[model samples]
Target: MKTDPTRYLARLRVTPGYEKAVPAPPSVGVLIVGYRACFAAAPAAGTPIASFEATTPVQIDAGAATAMALISVERATQRLRIRTEGGTEISWEENYFSAFGDSGTQWHLLPVDPSSHGGFVIARGAWAAGGYQAVLTRSTLIQAPFAPAVVSVHNVDPHTGERRW
Candidate 1:
């Protein structure tokens, strides 16, 4: 799987999402971790969704990085789960959490210290869970007035991997 563990906050600030290109400071930065998957938001059977029974509302797996877990108002019922694996000695430290979600989603926050060259997993279970994201903070959590936007470029047939548009 792909991963971003080295100064993710700093790395993410350069992207074209924040209100200001540069983040607040070393003490604060916002990171939006997007997951790729097809979700069945509306269940056909009833109010209960089958897929949600197998997994948490939000699940995050990271390699060589400390991960911050979050959810939105829609996913507030989802139970946040986190685990770390590596040689660095995983530690569950108290952290801060705030509101995170596009339309509906509930998020949670906790500091994770993974071992050297190790990995971690954070997940939750919520049938009505919506979209979610999180970030690792050094000093304090940073809340920006603007939200990040993701743009994807698809290339039909190109070995060079250049955007056709």
Candidate 2:
């Protein structure tokens, strides 16, 4: 049943793209409305280059709902993270906040070499590990087509911590 008007949330749109490797740090423009995070990728030296965006528009604000926000991309060694207004980064993977309940954030750091067939390191953390934790799962060389050479950071116990996914 519809409890209250402020108890609902909006939908999210995630769009991804591929382009030339950026050699330097990019001048990125990010927008975070409420708990939704919008990603805008640009050139290293600062240009409106091609980009991808994932909106973390779902968040539980002082209620009994589950809000989720996350970002994922293959072959990503480094990424630009979104943070609070005063530069307080949400975490490595994403930022999550809630007044309703504590689903915290699900953090996953997967080191994957899509072009190579080798090993992987997976580290993850979440409720099972005391609410929010980030750990890696290691694996040996994998030379399979469908098998991900991906080591995933499995779960997160809280809304903190960052990693090089």
Q: What overall lDDT goes with each candidate model?
A: 0.26, 0.22
User: Candidate 2 — which residues are off by over 4 angstroms?
Assistant: 1-60, 76-155, 158-165
Clashes of each: 15, 31
Tens digits of per-residue lDDT, candidate 2, 6-123, equal 2222221111221232122112211111111123211111111111122122322323222221222222122446565655333232223234333322222222111122211122
Please tell me which predicted candidate would have the highest lDDT against the true structure.
Answer: 1
lDDT of 1 by residue, 8-80 (tens): 3422222235336333322333322322221212111112211211122233333223233222123222334
Superposition TM-score, candidate 1 onto the true structure: 0.21
Once fitted onto the true fold, the runs of candidate 1 whose alpha carbons sit more than 4 angstroms away are: 1-4, 10-67, 70-73, 76-103, 107-109, 115-118, 121-165
In the order shown, what is each candidate's alpha-carbon RMSD? Answer: 20.0, 22.1
